[model samples]
Target chain A: MFLETVLLAQRELRRNVLRSSLTVLGIVIGVAAVITLVTIGNGATQQVAEQIGSLGSNMLQLRPGQGFRGPGGASSDSKRFTLEDAQAISNDIPGLAAVAPTANASTQAIYGNENWSTSITGSTNDFLKVRNWDLDSGREFGDGELQSGRAVCIIGATVKKELFGGQEPIGQSIRLKKIAFQVVGVLKSKGQASFGNDQDDFVLIPIRTLHRRIAGNADVGGIMVSVRDADAIDEAKSAIERLMRERRRIAYGGQDDFNVGDMREIMSTVTGTTKILTALLAAVAAVSLVVGGIGIMNIMLVSVTERTREIGIRLAIGALGREVMMQFLVEAVVLSGFGGIVGIALGLGAAAAGSVVLKVPFVLEPGIVVLAFGFSSVVGIVFGFFPARKAARLDPIEALRHE
Target chain B: MNETPVSSNNNGAAANGAAANGALIRLQAVTKVYGTGIAAVEALKGIDLRIGQGEFVAIMGPSGSGKSTCMNILGCLDVPTAGTYFFQGRNVGRLTQDQRALLRREHLGFVFQGFNLLGRTSALENAELPLIYRGLPVKKRRVLAREALASVGLSGWETHTPAELSGGQQQRVAIARAIVTHPKVLLADEPTGNLDSERSREVMELLTALNRDRGITILMVTHEPDMAKYAARQVHFMDGLIDGRSTEGGA
Candidate 1:
């Protein structure tokens, strides 16, 4: 019985191919818009998480201010962390893997006829360990270099590409702010950061060398720390916070001047924003689905009226009321189901193209596809019920008599 | 007119035979009123009717004479407002709408003056519609529909749609559909009203052949005396009441 009804529905739809296609057009556009927006949004979220993950494994950054507003913008009353503070934290804090105090100054690096403007970072060997950075060639500064504050520097891949072109940069001399320094190593490439800054566009030198030649001060801008075990991150954060508070001589009930930011927190904030945007887009797209449903209802009502004689014939030929209703309902569902399939295909194609343009991963979520298709069918039923019932309740005598 | 009153014999053997070939449709004091109070029209006013099994009866009346209303009630398409209707010994007035539909589906077939075949559908599918409602499998439905179409002399026109066929051929397809289920009673409302003289004769001849060959009971409503001549009996209606009836031959 159900199969017969379905065939009847198919025949009826086939009889009016143009009208059926036009009726389903709204549903197609609605489903496609929802799927495309959600797919692109999810891809962006995944890309953000991946970029933040690439920064470091189980790392935290401590700035000498209440927040990361900018360089040299710390609270005037707050004291900057010195190299001693970094060493103290490394020795005193348990579960600590590495701690590096970093200070940066933007300067022009000159080598022969080539010169490039880039940020110059100064830190100990532990900076590379905390950042999970590795050298492409050459070696780190020796202990003597650190102790005597030798004029030795390590250039990042961007600096090397800019200053030396294709030439070997190792054992070469580069001048930073008029002070010549030997390039002892070249850091490996680390692509763009999550915030769109080039991670490989800087030069690294010993902190003492930077203080003497560049900044002429012993103030460290920030501290980068890595925990040995992922499970002990919270413990290490509290331990370092307590030590810094005591060393800086903060009284009881006083807020600490420095702020520690976890990489996980940054990752969550970015991903959360993307998720909210996705939900909002989906909600707006859902309104289109409702509009599509209304379109279906309007067309179905028209169909019932137009086919009154046909419905009457079926009813007189012994079709039960529910049978007539089922035929129309099946027609509606088939229309929306076809629309959903075409919409999914179009949406996925658009999403893939968008992913390439946006430089994000292509994430295909199967659950959304099923949900979209199912929801479209439900829309047909919800909107189609009234017309079906109206058709079913039609008086066979009057319907047959209809002109 | 050869008129014979209903026999009153109470013999057990005769009663069994009479019951076996008894009235397939019986209406007593059936009244159908349209609207209410001053606005109401009595479409049927206390009609009493009996159509025996295997009898071809023509209901003849002018417009608004309630012949169509009688046909509607007999076909289970409408229920009487105040009366008891019995079909094959079952009280039809008390049956629910679905039950009446089931009775129509199983034991009755209808032919409309408009042909009422679904447009754009092939003659074969139109013929198979009743069987589809009967829940016959596709293979069996196709076979039965093919046979019914052949029986109506439309053997080569199975795939032709109503628009593609002539009026006579379309009426043949309608007849094929009406008899596809081998219904016990076929109710045809103005079966030949739309056709010209030649096509009307053809459709009447086809209905007559179906009755003679299949012993299928037929109740047809027509105002044309020529169309009424095809039936074995004629029941005349005037103002919603059966004014008179005539039998063509002695039983």
Candidate 2:
């Protein structure tokens, strides 16, 4: 009986092919929009997480301020950390893998006639270890250079490309603000960080050289620390915080002047924002599903009215009320089901194209596809019930008599 | 009014005798009103009727004379306002709408003036509709529909839709649909009204054959006297009442 009703519904839909197609158009658009929006949103979130993750593994940054309030805060009296403080933390902390006290200044570097404005970072060889960076060529600062405060520096990949052009820069001299420094090594390309900063646009020099020849201060801007084990990050952070408080001579219950930020916390903040945006866009897209359902209901009602005589004939031929209802309901389901299939295909294609344009990972969520399809079928049923009931409740005599 | 029995052939005679005293359809003081109070129109007014099993009866009247209302009540398509109706000894007046539909589904067949086959549907599927409602398997229903179509001389026209066939062929398809379920009674309302003279004769002949050979009781409503001549007995309605009856040339 069910199969026969389905056949009947197919015939009815086939009879009015144009009208049926138009009716299902709304559902197709709604499902496709929902799936495509969600897919792109998921891809964006994944991209954000991956970009943040590439900054460093199990690393933390301690800055001379409370939280992320920039360098100036109410604790203006707080003292900045120096190379000695970095040495103390490295010696005192058990799980410490590398501790580098870094200070940066924006200056122009001159290589013969080519001069480019770039930031210069002053740190020891441990800076590369803490930042998870590597050199593509050349060697790190030798013990002689670090101890004697020699004018020696390593250029990043971007700096190498800008200053050297196609020429070799090893053992070559570059002038930074009237001070000449020998290029000891070149760093590998690290690409852009999550915050959209170019990591390879800086030159690294020894802390002693940067303090004595440039900034003329022993103050370190921040401390970058890498934990020996991934699971020991929290312990390392606590140990470092306690040591800093004790060395700074902070009274008990007094707030520490320094702030320690984990890489994972920054990653979560970025990913969380993307997730919220994705959900908001997806919710807006879901409203169209309801609109599509309303379209189905409207068209079904018109169909029932138009086929009054046909319904009358079925009833007179001894079809039960529910049977007639089933036929119409089945027609509705078939329409929405077809729309769902077409929508899924279109959504997948659009999402793939969108991912390419947006430069994000193409993520296919099978669960959402199934959910959208199932929800469309449910929409058919919910919207179809009213028209089917009206058709079922029609009086055979009056319906037959209808011209 | 005379209650003479009319038999068209020897087979019809024996079948008619068996059903002569058994009323397959009985109505007592049946009244159907269309609306409420002053705006109401009584379509059927205190109608009393009796039709025996295997009997071929024709109901004839002009527009608004209640012939169609009487046919509707007999077919269980509408309920009477103030009367009891019995079909095969069961009180149909007390039956719910769904129960009435079930009774029609199991034991009755109907033909309409419009040759009301579903548009865009083939003849065989139209014929198979009642059996489909009966929940018969597709194979069995198809076989029965083929036999019914062949019986109506439409064996090779099974795949033709109503719009693709001539008026005569469409009426034949409607007849095939009516008899496919082997119903005990067939109710036809102006079945030949839309056909020409020749096509009308063909449809009437088909209805007569089913009544004579299969012993299926037939009740038809029509306005044309020529169409009424095919039935063994004739009942006349005037102003929502059964005015007279004639059973001339009957068994």
Q: Clashing residue pairs in candidate 1, if any? A: none
Worst 10 contiguous positions by lDDT, candidate 2 chain B? B1-10
Candidate No. with top lDDT: 1
Candidate 2 local lDDT, A245-353, one digit each (tens): 9988889999889888887877777778888988888788778888888888999999999899989988988888998898889988888877788888988889999
lDDT of each: 0.87, 0.86
Count backbone overlaps in model 1: 0
For candidate 2, write residues B1-251 as lDDT tens digits.
Answer: 12323332243335545444366776778899989999999999987666877889988988999988888889998889997677877778889888999999888999888888888889999999889888899899999999999999999999998889999999899999999989999999999989999999999999999999999999999999999998988988899998856452243
lDDT of 1 at A143: 90
Candidate 1 residue lDDT tens string, A1-403: 6766777787788888999889999999999998999999999899888977876657878887675443234444467889888889988888878888898899899999999999998998989998778999999989999877899999899999999999998888999989999999999998866556788998999988988889999998888999999888888888888999998889999988987778788788778888999999998998898898888999999999999998999899899999889988998888888888888898899999999998888999999999999999999999999999999999999999988
Predicted candidate 1 versus true structure: per-residue lDDT over B1-251, tens digit per residue: 11222333233225345443356666778999989999999999997666777888988988999988888889998889997677886777889999999999999988989999998999999999988778899999999999999999999898999999998899899999999999999999999989999999999999999888998999999989999999989988889888856543212
For the predicted complex of model 2, DockQ is: 0.69
- Candidate 1: list runs displaced more than 4 Å: A65-79, A105-118, A137-153, A159-185, A209-217, A251-255, B1-21, B245-251
